[model samples]
Target: MYKVIRKILFLLPPEEAHYVSLFLLQLICSTPFTRKLLRNFFEPVKVSPITIAGIHFRNPVGLAAGFDKNALHLRELSCLGFGHVEIGTVTPQPQRGNERPRLFRLPADNALINRMGFNNDGVVTIAKRLKYWREEVQPYVDLEKPLIIGGNIGKNKSTSNEEAWRDYEFCFERLHPWVDYFVVNVSSPNTPGLRALQDRSFLEKILTGLQKKNQEMKNPKPIFLKIAPDLEWIQVDEVIELVLAIGLDGLVVSNTTIRRDALLTPPNTVSRMGAGGLSGAPLKERNTSLLAYIHKKTNGKIPLIASGGIFTATDATEKFKAGASLVQVWTGFVYEGPAIAKNISAASPV
Candidate 1:
């Protein structure tokens, strides 16, 4: 059914199609009758519990950060059956992202390239909505064992690289209470000069600042770093060092890659879609290798939340065998539709 719907959705502009699909989810999951009925469409199957940092997730498959920029779909998304849903990459203030045509679909290769530069309603607005979820919806959703929520934080576009840590600090303080864990996103290609924060010195400083605040908190949540798949080998080594030096809780094995190679889509089509992060099947090998490499360097000391081209159960299994404690889905969810979480988990080693 989703594949058929995907065929129809594919015809529309990718951005429009995204909104439409979310609308349908909101529409169905909002109604009590529809919500109950739709539950049957998504069957829940227990794989195994995954413990990372200090919390336990029902399954290893999670929806990656960019999918739900704000916490708007918390209720609806949980209904789609993801073990966890990461929201944000949200900034200090809301900003209309780059011009449209920012999201492009490459169906030929089951991938997507997006330059949707941290487009979100900022932290304040998102906090208000999040408060409602945290206060009202989340409690009722089962606090004893509620669905996991991760806050993926990033700085605003206007912030200079020198003052960037302030932006991350601002967001960390605000989202600290609501989210279950944190992913410090400094690797997005869409944001100008943002990737520069990946530098070992700067990244250590940023994580150290956040870690200090977390330690002071009455309740400190797990904070992880999200790095770019485009990093050079030396850069990866720097990251491994940073993770160990800071004692960061974990690492999300990637954001997206800027390098576009072996894409089934023609160069002309890709060139027209210019300037965005490439994610999907093209990312599977690199993402898996990254996890393996990081595991080897860290000696399996740091936890890893693998993200990249997870289109099927096989792709997910590779991540698990490679050393990922958990896995996140982005391009797969877009191309494979809602059953993806269940589909992947059903066949995973976990």
Candidate 2:
């Protein structure tokens, strides 16, 4: 079973283990016979195709943006049965994220803390790769299957808040043609003061700028805002208001939380890990609260993509019960492995 294998995988540094697994997955998925064999291990569900922003999702479970920062693994990721795979916290310029040991694992809690600092291959590279994905990679998969692709955009670490909108705009304009939807990421804790962009005034500038350009295009992609679960209720209220006023397509209810309160992991060990957003089992309750709050604030007018610590069918279903139209996974995928997406989709509300 995966538990035993996971124990061995856990023996390696978290970051290296991730790549090792990714490499193995890509290898298995590259061949038809092996891909089908792996597919059988994932239980299928009666997917209720949900329509949002005029796009159809065969199911509601999606891969969160941080996992595949560029589009490199879209085919491999989508083959695992996620209804969508959001790629990138991509910036205008590529940068090596934080230095060595930026990712840490809390095995006892089934969680990860990362100061990846938007480490990515950049928007131009990602966009170019995406063009090939849409043109070539996707066609080989099951037909008209998952929503399959999204671009999650953010600013470079070196960029100032005043010029931050330009970074987002750059990614937005370039990636629009290939991705199904756009998630504006301003909530990550790793980037210096990136969370400050969640401010109403600053967020308005970014969203408004994107929307203006979106309208000018003959084909406008659906755009949603991704927010941090660290937000207070008043801040959540402001975000809900902004989404409504800006006519933004939707909101990704919550990102990783900065709060380390009451975790089973000892404070000193956690503190030693240094600065980064925390995601996994500990995030479930607060994540649900924020999603339910956002749904209540908008009176369910805005579609929500619930994400935080989901690692099981029940956790993802709770997001739906709290009113998410879709859900995404990062920590959950790490914990549950390939079965994660299918498990949640099968448990989705009828």
Candidate 3:
């Protein structure tokens, strides 16, 4: 059914297709009857719940960050049966991201290349939306379990690296009350100098500041770091060491990769897509390996949420086998249609 729908959607531009599809879903979900019908049709079979960093996830499959950048579609997205929906790589202030044509599809490779540059409605606005979801919409959603919400926060592209910690701090404070967990995003390749925050000195300052603020809250949310898959092993070691030392809650295992090697997409075609993080099937092995490395290096002390190339039960099971406590899907959700979470959860052991 989605294959036929996808063909129609594929005719439009990738970014255009994204919103058009979601808008249609949101329209269907606007009514209580249709919403409940959609929920029943798409909801995953009940699986034993799992807890990580003190948050309960009804299933391991979640929609990754960048899907609902502004917290606009939580009610509609919840009906699709994701155990969690991570919103934002939100900045302290809203900014129009890089130019259009920033998001591209690599259908031959089952991949997407995006240089979205954290284009979002910013922290304050998104937080308000989240608060509304919790206070108004969540209660009426006919689901057996609550959908977990994660805030994936980042600095504005204009923010200097020296002052980047402050940006992260600002976002964390605003979003703390609303999101179930927070993912510090220093890994996105689209934002200029953003990835530099992953350096030990810079990263430590940001994580420690956020942690300090977190502790001050009566009920602190879990803090996780999202890293790029292109990192060298030494860089991974630095990240693992910092995470263990700071008592950070977990790692998201990966963001998208800047590397474009080994793709089925033609070189000229991929080059034309240009300068965005690459994600999807091309990412699975490296991300899985990174998860395993972190799991072994931390001796399983740090919980991990696998993201990247997960599109099916087998992909998800691979993540679980590599010690991921949870998994997130962005490109997979786009490529696999609405049943992605349900399909993966139904077959995954975790």
Candidate 4:
């Protein structure tokens, strides 16, 4: 079972275990024989199909952005039965990100804290990979439905707030033809002063620029804003207002939170782990509350993609009840293993 494999993986360092797991999965998925066997074991489950932001999803469960930052594992991950897979918080240029020991696991709280700082291959390289997928690889998968891909983008750490729009625009333009949708990420806590761009004036500027560029495309992709859970109601309201005013497609109802209150993980241990956004079970209450609030405020008119703390069918159902049209998983996927998407999709409400 996954618990046994997880125990072995847990013995390794968090970040190391991640790459090892992905590498193995990538290898398994590379060959059609292994890929078919894996897909049979973890078959896709179609629950209530829904269309959000003009894209049709075979199911509501999706892989959250941070899991596959460079679009490397889309073929394999899709076999695990996610309706969508979002890649990147990709910048215009590749980044080294923060120092090592940046990712920590809190088994007691079922949470992870990461100051990864948008570490990823830059837009150009990632776009090339995607181009191959579209032209060469996609024809082979032959699924019943197409997997929706979301491009989650942000600025490089060295980029200033004033010049941030250029970075976002660069990514938006480059990824436009390849990705099914786009998420503007100005909410990550790891990047210094990045969250400042979430302010109404600055957000308007960045989003409007992306939207303008998006319109120039013969087929403009759906654009969504990924917001932090730390924002106050007033701030969230302002975001809703901007979303409506700009005619943006939707919102991803949170990134990870910087707050670390009430965790079962001891204070000393948590302090040792240090600064980064905390995600997983500890995030459930706050994440769902924010979902409900956003749903209520927007009168359930604006589509929402719920992230944070979803680990089970019940969790996905809770998000649906709270007004999320789609749900994404990152920490849960780490904990629950590859069967998660299939399991959650099977258990989802009719």
lDDT of each: 0.89, 0.87, 0.92, 0.92
In candidate 3, position 268 carries an lDDT of: 98
- Candidate 2 residue lDDT tens string, 144-218: 564458889999999999999999999998998999999999999999999999999899999999999999999
Model 1 agreement with the true structure over 1-350: per-residue lDDT tens digits: 88899999999999999889998899878776776566556645757778899888978889999889988888777777778999998899998899998999998998999999999999988878888898888676546556799999999999998898999999989888788899999999999999999997789889999999999999999999999998999999988888888889999999889999999899999999999899989999999999999998878999999999998899999999999999999889888889988888889997
Ten residues in sequence with the least summed lDDT for candidate 2? 38-47
Give the Å shift of residue 235 in candidate 3.
0.8
| TM-score of each predicted structure versus truth | 0.97, 0.97, 0.99, 0.98
What ranking emerges by TM-score with the best candidate at the front? Answer: 3, 4, 1, 2
lDDT of 2: 0.87
lDDT (Cα, 0-100) at 109 in candidate 2: 88
What tens-digit string does per-residue lDDT give for candidate 4 at 64-121? 9889999998898887888899999899999989999999999999999999999999
Worst 10 residues of 3 by lDDT: 136-145
What ranges in model 1 sit over 4 Å off? Answer: 142-144
Q: What is the lDDT of residue 334 in candidate 3?
A: 82
TM-score of 2: 0.97
